[model samples]
Target: MDASASPAAAAPDPASTPGPGPVPPPAPVSRLRRLAVPVGAMAAAVAAFGYVAAVDPNEPGHYPVCPMLRFTGLLCPGCGGLRSAHAFAHGDLATALGSNALAVVGYVVLAVVWLLWTVRASRGRPLRIGVAPVYWWGIGAVLLVFSVVRNLPFGSALAP
Candidate 1:
């Protein structure tokens, strides 16, 4: 019990204290689990495309006309999307573009995004597509312009 040698001085150094070793890495994901969501999504899309390809949307009564076009006699953004999908599924690029160029572009965009999503999921890193509100608003504005332009005689080429 010397004045200079306190009880605290007898304690062991924290750095030297024994504890659990370094943590192990996370378990690898199962192959089936890795492919499940991407595969399922692709299968569903393929099924829908297949249906559209077989059904012939150009035939009257096969698919309902867009309500906006029906009520207002004005082409909406999605007026010819079904016909575009139908033509795209049949490998008719020109017909697809003629039906709705924007919808054809949308198909290409969806394919690219789905490819990236599948690749990331297979690698055990899921993709999170988070677009800002401003970008969404810009997309809406573009769609509005497209709709308005397609309805005008000057932009009749875009009409379905």
Candidate 2:
């Protein structure tokens, strides 16, 4: 009747217990598999740039007019983006900046982000582009200001 002699006090044998076995490590990723997404994305981007570089957007009909500009005479943030890309692709940085400074900044930002993504993908790591909602709103606000300024007489230099 001693508490120390109770059957319930004995520990169960781990070998006798049914449980999940040790987990296997994840399979190694092949180099091609690891780099596939980034390389494909870069290829698509290069193709698009090549097309834009060859076909001029300044010719008016080559690209569609911005509806905002066409309808209301108001320039939207992306009004001259194609022209900017064309200028950028041809290495005319000044014309690119004149066409759309924001678009030039966008190209730089895309390049930086793509570089980071490519590097992370090559290393077999997930690309993390977690921008906060506030930052996105801030970017929108900046674009709006840029659009408004470029349309005004004082900011004519920003107009395409």
Candidate 3:
């Protein structure tokens, strides 16, 4: 011991000593914080779907008709998507496809992705959005083709 040291500091005191004792674990997250994002998304999706179902696209003047169809006498890729969703919600698969085959395909894809997202979230994993550039390009190309073909007289069936 050094002669200059304080008497209190000189003696090793077990009561005053600080060491790494057992550390308490972090508190678990609150339920609201954990579920907020997912619940909000689902609510929004459901609300949008419900709104589309309630508003009839087929009934002229209820919803604005597609201007592209009026001007060029063509069916745009998104022309009948609202009607398709309405039909789909009502379990009219054929009518849904007739309204917009692309939209039906999109709905199926959305359902699958949503299912996967929900499962992953429940398992405490982050949401995944993995799409290659090629896949994106392919989707774009398909939409372009649908738009062009539906406009042509030859693809009258594809027209809304």
* Full-model lDDT for every candidate: 0.91, 0.91, 0.83
Highest TM-score: which candidate? 2
Model 1: residues >4 Å from true position, as ranges?
Answer: 1-27
lDDT of 3 by residue, 1-160 (tens): 6775988667988866898877899897665666667877878988988887888777878788779878977678999888889898888999999888999999888878877776677666778799999999999999999999877888877766
lDDT of 2 by residue, 1-160 (tens): 8876877667777878889977899999997898998899999999999999999998868888888998999889997889999999999999999899899999999999999998998888999889999999999999989988988999988898
Positional deviation of residue 17's Cα in model 3 after best superposition, in angstroms: 19
lDDT for position 130 in model 1: 97
Clashing pairs in 1: none
Could you give candidate 1's per-residue lDDT for residues 1-160 as a string of tens digits?
A: 7854877877778878997867899999987899898899999999999999999988898888888888989999888889999999999999999999999999899899999998888888879999999999999999999999999999999999
List the candidate numbers ranked by lDDT, top first: 1, 2, 3
TM-score of each: 0.82, 0.84, 0.75
Which model is ahead, 2 or 3, in terms of TM-score?
2
